[model samples]
Target: MLAIKGVSRRFGGKTAVADVNLEIAPGAFIGVIGRSGAGKSTLLRMLNRLVDPSEGTISFDGVDVTALRGQALRDWRARCAMIFQQFNLIGRLDVLTNVLMGRLNKVSTASAVLQLWGLEDKAMALAALEQFDIANLAGQRADSLSGGQQQRVAIARALVQEPSIILADEPIASLDPRNTKVVMDALLRINKHFGITVICNLHSLDLARGYCDRLIGMSAGRVVFDGAPAALTADAARDLYGLEAGEVMDADADVKWAGQARPASAAA
Candidate 1:
């Protein structure tokens, strides 16, 4: 489990995340929801240590991850993989090679720099590709693939890391509705089958409601609501999303999607 205590992040004079506290349990699918500038991305980046907190600490299994540095930091990053809205693969690299980059944190610098992967590493990457049903595209360049294909490739890359936790920052924000379902279903499979804790930042309430067991709402950079998706009332959503709460509350109001009305787990 991971514990976030009074965590906050600021950029110059502006605060991006403020005094947020939450405990993330294992094998849980939790969605952080809010409109733009709500600090959801900042929260995930802090968890992955891509951005250091301005105050407070984040600990995993009783160790203060905020204090980790050098090799320890690298190792922690490998254990905590991140999936971004924009698929962050090297455009020039083949899909298989892009996925093998996940193993770089665990390999020697010489091997990594030379792109010399072991048979086992190649096999693992290939298997991850196959898991996402993208094995045939392994030889294709990342930039040449469609957006959905690229995102799946990104997910496969994250899977090859063998992470204990995955922090997805708007993984489906840029995809079409069909691709959105595909990506969300893929994340659900990862969380359920592999028992990896997945904390994702999402904008669509229907998608979040359908896939995530718990939903955490943010407003003005602080957590305002944290509970089950069904427990998230329209009133609470109003506080989370302001005028757009109507969209957040009514799943079918502005969007047409088959991803609504899924059951969620009991609150942790």
Candidate 2:
């Protein structure tokens, strides 16, 4: 459903993403994993046109995303929603109102402003909250909720747009282990049940292996590995992470949380 070819991004003389090519199929759950400064976030931003690539092309469902302008760009962005690591909720607005903000593209600015008084937009917003089990908090301010609740609220907001693809950049970076699992479960459920294409940037190899069907590992400013999670081995991970195989294997409990036994393909 999404294709990125020969995409590159540069900041002054340094390149952040170089010659990256990827194809994400419909209903696929793909994870982009790498160390800091590996260009994972830059690549994700380019996919949604949040950051214009310095070179090459990005197409979504056959339309050249780079070619869109004004209303066309706005519409394209609406179809491809993004979820940030930070909840990005409007602190003063009630949870429902914050979620309703997702539909601002579809409604006039005037109608959006008046949405707080239980209008048709309120109903639409409530429906979105219900999807994430946040309906009970509709009337409460977004800042009043816990981190997990806030993230769910953000996800509901993204869902309100009915996006065909969701780009989440380190969506669990701020959460605790429990909250991380909650957020990841919600994302996986969305992909499995609703068939929305999901591309997540994650730092945890185990989390990527556990939640994503395929993994894309980046090193420096280039894609070093792109394959099934089961295809990532200790040696391959060492190379991707730029460390000794044993060192990479022993780095974090979570990174090795999948189990003592490695997948047969990855073991090879």
Candidate 3:
């Protein structure tokens, strides 16, 4: 289990995340929802150690994740992979090379710098691309693919890392409707087929409702609601968004509240 106790993050005078606690089990699909700047990104960054917590502890299984350093920290990062909104990839490199980069931490620095990928590594990367139905694009430049294809490359790269958990920060925010559905389906497949825990930050309540087994609602850096999607009542949503629940319902065709917390999901 992944356990967080009293976790918080602050930047100068601003508290990005505050006194947050959660226990996430393996193979669970969790969706985190909140308005922009409500600490959702900061929370995920802290989990991957891209940002350090101001106070509290995070533990994975029996290990103390907060105390990892140097190689240990790098190892921790490998175990907990992060997929970004922009689909971070080496645009100049071939898709295969970009996927091979996921093994950098496991290889010697000299070998990695020299780009000495063994046959086994190439096979591994090829297999990952095949899993995403992108093996044909292996020889193509990463920037040459469509947005949806590039996002698939990013997911394949994460798979090559063999991570036990994936933290996706607005992964489908930039994709079109068709691609959004594809990406969400890919994430679901990874979680179900491989038993990898997935914690995603999402802006679309519709996508959250459709893809997530459980939802977490945050307001002003604190968790306001946590339960199965069906348990999220109208009153709970009001407290979560500080507005009438209907205002942010993604299914509402006429919703255009100034505080548009949830928009219609591209996946829908």
lDDT of 2 by residue, 53-78 (tens): 99999998899998888999988888
Worst 10 residues of 1 by lDDT: 259-268
Clashes within 3 Å, all models in order? 0, 0, 0
Tens-place lDDT per residue, model 1, 35-72, is: 99999999999999999999999999999999999999
- Candidate 2 Cα outliers beyond 4 Å, as residue runs: 116-120, 244-268
Task: Compute the lDDT of residue 90 as modeled in candidate 1.
Answer: 98
Q: What TM-score does each of the candidates earn?
A: 0.94, 0.89, 0.91
Higher lDDT: candidate 1 or 3?
Answer: 1
| Pairs clashing within candidate 1 | none
Residue-level lDDT of model 3, residues 53-167, one tens digit each, is: 9999999998999999999999999999999999899999999999998888778999899999989888999998998889999999999999999988888888888899999
Candidate closest to the true structure, highest lDDT: 1
Worst 10 residues of 3 by lDDT: 258-267
Ranking by TM-score: 1, 3, 2
